[model samples]
Target: MITIQYAIIGGTGVYDSGVASIQKTVNTEYGKVEVDIAEVEGTSMVFLARHGKEHGIPPHLINYRANIKALQELGVQHIFATAAVGSLNPDYPTGSLVVLSDFMEMTKQRPLTFFEGGTDDVKHVNMDDPYCGNLRKHLLEAAKLHKIQFKGNAVYLCTEGPRFETEAEIRMMRKWGADVVGMTSVPEVVLAKELGMCYASVGFVVNMATGMESGPIQLESIGDMLARNKEKVNKMFLDIFSKTLDQQNCGCADSIVCL
Candidate 1:
């Protein structure tokens, strides 16, 4: 029965929050989610590993609905997520840390919304500022105060995975204005929007895209950037949550509307 106002959805190389914490299981209608509860200066935050604790879940196979629902049930209103992505733009090479500004979805076969003509009724969620501009501002402010070196902003493209993209796909993605590519942001972001929760994320460039590099994708070396910046990003999130958040800064909580 832990009450939390903030949650962190850790993707790809992000597993733990690097702090002392306790675990709790939240049961939702969709499924059950296990989250870590940690406190920072009297603020309670929950940490949920997007890919499971052991990285056993694939991107497309993730239970996005359950994850969001669990957080909502826990009274989580602000979500800060981490993404380990491949750099498509030359400016964002490996080890670059970028704030996610926007996102395009290439996901297929996964549930994209909570309003699936269910008892909740049909509704539409606004996507103009899908990543929660309010939280983004807080994130940047926290980073500056903590002296975390953030590279810049990036447009993330979410692809259905379990498999890396081909060279041709990478070329097409670059033309579509994608700055970085990752597997798990689509439905996760969408679900958060549907639930009217403030969600924002930081992207860690772990490697170059399929054809961007001369060689093939090396799974072994993808965590270099993640290892270096995991602590900083977590600290930044904690810092942001430790302060008083102004709900009127953006329209994130007003995203949902009846169809």
Candidate 2:
């Protein structure tokens, strides 16, 4: 029985658990969740590759429930998620990092909660503050420590995909005040709240959205961009681990009302 206080959900460009000293698969009601247990800067943590180690699973197909449940079982209290996103807002250009302050769910399908039928009554979790403020503050502090330029606040719009969003969809998201767009942040963020875990997401802007550029959306370029800028994301997490992994003054643990 391995225990950890923090967990990292690594998104695109972050596949391998960098300093993981142990690797294991956790069985859950939803599915088997693969995780890596690591010690970074003397702080013990767990890492889960959101897209799988091989990048085999798509965003819509990820076993979100199992992943979240496994972390909960491991005694994880704070979750830091990283995402490679497209900039919907012009101010957040490519190569910029945005700490998600809020999110808009545009996903059409997927199980969004754990209290479907296991409880006596329906469980409705409060989402007034979806992203944990304490964790976000820490991340921002880490960025400042490293002198890494980042957007302190941004609204993430999550779209269901193995496919990218169209130009019109990007426009709509921008109109809705979304700064960044991605595929995996929806149920993941929501589920963390359900478990009373403080969750924060750091998004790396890989490109401008479909219509933001004059030419056709280059699918190949996104990968190249992520590869080129993943180090910034890596450094941000490392700094967070070294500087701010222990501060948990928020009410995330009390967010669950009907457990």
**TM-scores for all candidates?**
0.96, 0.92
Evaluated with TM-score, which candidate comes out highest? 1
lDDT of 1 by residue, 156-219 (tens): 9999887888999999999999999998888888888888788998998888889998998766
Superposition TM-score, candidate 1 onto the true structure: 0.96
Error of 1 at 250 (Å): 0.7
Judging by lDDT against the true structure, name the best candidate.
1
Task: Residues 133-206, candidate 2: write the lDDT tens digits.
Answer: 98888877777777777765889999898788899988888889999999999999999988989899888888
Give the Cα-based TM-score of candidate 2 against the true structure. 0.92
Error of 2 at 158 (Å): 0.7
lDDT of 2: 0.83
lDDT of each: 0.87, 0.83
